[model samples]
Target: MPFILTRITRDGLSRLMAKYVVGQIVCHERGWMDTHMKQIKKDCIGWHTFHSFRSLDQLTVGVMGLGKIGLTTAKVLKGFGCRVHGLVRTPRSHSSVEPFVDQLWHGREGLADFLKDCDYLVNLMPSTPLTHGLLGDEVLTGASRRPVIVNVGRGDIITEADLLKALEQGWIFAAVLDCYEKEPIPEDSFLWTHPRVVMTPHNSYNNNEDYKRHHIQTEFIVNFENFLAGQPLTGEVDWQTGY
Candidate 1:
């Protein structure tokens, strides 16, 4: 059988994930959900108790792995008047993300500096040798801002034990996790009950099955045409880089 390499177009998915990140930042970092829940339960209606909440415009956000999803997230945050920062494996000239990012960091050498002052750190990196367990004690400890962790990336990017320690030790504020080191997260996991955690079962990319199938078929048709025309195919994987 002949194989035709293809992938679901990320434009729509990237936009959706970007919006999800913003929603997570607003609800988790600013304590909106907690406040709302309290009001619904008739626990408290006073505004003073929630005065600590900050506006999105006042935040400084850092995005790791400035790929399609990361770039989209940064752009959406910038639209809310945030000072956006981005981390990439290497530098690029005239990149699409340049306009949105106030500051950019290149490679692991600059990771510490990139994370230091961020009010929110969004992770969108893939699972790779360079990224596995990249956000452990050393990296988390360097964040002076005690940033809220927003991870929609591969879960292994963070060490679960170290993340728990960071929260316990106050190295970070809270977390909005859509992915985890383990699927189904085990019945005995602390993350399920952690006061500062808001988690989802990796549902960020979910959509109607029919809708997804339509897009996948469209992508395949486009790639097939490109192949016949001897044109560069979209979503071509770089085996060496493992993206």
Candidate 2:
């Protein structure tokens, strides 16, 4: 038997994650969570004095990692009239992402400068040695604007301890996390009770078994047909890149 893998849901997952990121930003900026809690606890209503609230178009969003998902996220944000910036480890030739971003920062040397200009920092990078702890003190401290950190990527990019310190030190405003250093986060984890944090199980991608099975079968059939026709397949993973 031969093993086959397909990323038939990559685009859908990216769009879903983008929506989550935008929703978190709106919730944080508009104080929706706090207001909801107060309404439930104190029976308060009509308390809508939000000093820090701002529209999405007024914010500058920085996206780390400009792969397929990152590019999709950027495109969605751009559609909302946001000033989007993208970061990559190296430069690409004639990249499709260029038209979606207002600025592009290349290499680690520019990370600090990039962080300084962002009102929201979205992380969509993969798990690799170079990306481990990449969002710790050194990089986060450069966020002079105190951007809200949104991590829909691998959790190991920033240590939980460092994330708390960054929040306490005022390096970043808050965090919206879908992934964590540990899954199902420990019962005693500070993140569970942190007021400035929002946690979600690693479900940015839809996990409906029926929907997934349908897509997988469709992708496989399409690829099999293409193979028979001596045509290229979609989502051919490169082992060396580990995508």
Which candidate tops TM-score?
Answer: 1
Q: How many pairs of residues collide in each model?
A: 0, 0
- Residue-wise lDDT of candidate 2 within 1-243, one digit each (tens)? 334544554466678778888888888888888888877777455455454788999999999998888888898888888999888876764355767888888767778778888999999998877788888756788888999999998999899999999999899889999999988799999999998999888787665787667666777788989978988889875555555
Over the stretch 1-243, how does candidate 1's per-residue lDDT look in tens digits? 434445555588888789889988877766777777778778764634745778889999999988888888888999899999888876765365678899888878889999899999999988888888888856789999999999999899887898899999998999889999988798998899999899988988777878577676778888889899999898876656667
Candidate 2 residue pairs in clash (backbone atoms < 3 Å): none
The regions of model 2 sitting more than 4 angstroms off are 1-5, 45-52, 93-95, 207-216, 224-232
**All candidates: CA RMSD (Å):** 2.7, 2.9
Which residue ranges in model 1 land beyond 4 Å of their true spot? 1-5, 39-41, 44-51, 94-96, 224-231
Supply the global lDDT for candidate 1. Answer: 0.84
10 residues in a row with least lDDT, candidate 1: 1-10
Q: What TM-score fits each model?
A: 0.89, 0.87
